[model samples]
Target: MRKGADTMQRASDSRTKTIVVVTIGVLILLPAAYGFIEKLTLFILAVKRDLIAGFTIIPVVNYLIVTAGMACLLIWAVAHGMFRRIEQPKYTMLEREEEIDRLDASENRTGEDR
Candidate 1:
């Protein structure tokens, strides 16, 4: 009975944590997204009326294209699970380094014997 209660408590805690994180993210991201959208709308209107200079439009379009490309890349990475095992690469790198050190030590020992 105590174990079951503890499990329930843990589950509740996890849910609360997820809710808090999502709430905070929404609070932060929504405003920034709104601002960007507002600016984009104004920029589009300006371009439509040919109010913006050609040089200015070129840079703005380039920025939009790069932002879109990066957003797509981020989506692709998330879908491919690139962020799931964020620490796995560090361990793999350390393991490779250890293997290389061992091989070098063995080579040195053999050279000393010869």
Candidate 2:
């Protein structure tokens, strides 16, 4: 019975992880897909002379700006230890709350008994 429960828990955890990964992947890809479509549209317009030559550079500039911004954010996250032991924060928060609760309970007991 314990083995079966453990297996079920593992399966659930794996499914949850997969879903989270897929969601994050979709979120990351959506903007890139949109940008590709926009750039393609701009290129088509430029080729047909519907857009000015100078306007054709808009997509390139936008891509550069976005890429640079993402790079900066990645660097900042790394520097600030955002990616280091991602699970640590979750456990740390829980531990902190438990500690606070313990302290509060102790104080309450002392105050009530006095």
Tell me the tens digit of each residue's lDDT in model 1 across 1-114.
999999999999989987998899899999999999999898788778785444588888899999999999999998999977689999999999999999999999999999
Q: Give lDDT for model 2.
A: 0.87
For model 1, the run of ten residues with the poorest summed lDDT:
46-55
- State the local distance difference test value for candidate 1: 0.91
Quantify all predictions' global Cα lDDT against the true fold: 0.91, 0.87
Candidate 1 TM-score over all chains jointly: 0.61
Model 2, stretches more than 4 Å misplaced? 1-53, 75-81
Which 10 successive residues of model 2 have the least lDDT summed?
47-56
TM-scores for every candidate against the unseen true structure: 0.61, 0.48
- The alpha-carbon deviation from the true structure for residue 34 of candidate 1, after best TM-score superposition, in angstroms, is 0.6
Q: How well is each residue in 1-114 modelled by candidate 2, as lDDT tens digits? A: 999999999999989987998899899999998998898787767767754575657787798799889989999997998876689989999999999999999999999998
